[model samples]
Target: PIPNSYWATPLLLACEYPWTPANPNKPKLDAVLHAGVRTFIDLTENGELRPYNGEVLATRAEFLGIDRQAIEYHRFPIHDRSLPESIEFMYSLMEVLRDNERRGRITAVHCRGGIGRTGMVIGCWLVESGRARNGEEALAIIAQKWKTVAKCNKYPHSPETGAQAEFVLHFE
Candidate 1:
């Protein structure tokens, strides 16, 4: 793992968008290539990541290769501060995370700033992976590790919004 990396699981990490605009705000996969992230699970939409004028909405995801030709890069573009639009998509995302870990792939999951959206998915994973007994425990673990980072979605909770929290709470 990298120095400032945050882990959702030993193999799965939570991070902000791994790219910035300053380096032309492009996808900088090489920057984190040393982290040995064989897989990247990006939970951001196209516009949500990438370089911007005001600031570079970056993440610490182990490594995200939007390069398309990389060994692995999976994107699930849910809106910020929100849950996945569909239950099926959410299931698929969780399945991928679980599968990647089981396969021993060092996977990374990221969203804008690695806060609300990141916390939501990672919290769900904590339950899904059996790291926590339930969503409440999962949220507590994430909130403790992230501290102030968990308040972005208008809630002092890991999943940020009610819908997100509920989704994680009832996640299968």
Candidate 2:
């Protein structure tokens, strides 16, 4: 696999919530709850990660006293980067994130390193937030913020899939 240029988003903050990293250097936990984050959304991939355990995230939420009711975790596989089904899974994940945001919930979203998958989710959020006019512009904004660019599928498995990915990301 080719190395990506960008680091993922550590935490995407909305007006309703103030987000802070678990640790300033490497934010393992999405967003700390006591610091005004009403909802904690863990968007990381699972199934084989030993250190970033899903149970730990749940435990942190329980410890934070953040009502645990507001948290959501949806796992979408990140391997096989060129798969259309994977791309669709990302979209479905976006729908879940967008719904909470629409309800005025402040969400702290994160994945490993806060880059690739994290960046894509953040890009979708920006689009949904109207902070970004389009997907192209959103990508540029994200690249600028993180000092790294997202990859365009150079080996897109199918023309239709490539076109589908391109179509949704119009503003950036």
In order of appearance, the predictions have TM-scores of 0.74, 0.57
| Candidate 2 Cα errors over 4 Å, as ranges | 1-31, 38-43, 51-55, 80-87, 147-172
Task: Please give, for residues 1-172, the per-residue lDDT of candidate 1 as tens digits.
Answer: 3332376667777766665556643444444444666677788787764532111212333225333333477788889888888878877988998788888888777776677777888888888888999988888888776653433345445556778777777876
Which sections of candidate 1 miss by over 4 Å? 1-5, 24-31, 51-70, 148-157
- Residue 102 alpha-carbon offset, candidate 1, angstroms: 1.6
lDDT of 1: 0.67
Which 10-residue span in candidate 2 carries the lowest summed lDDT?
1-10
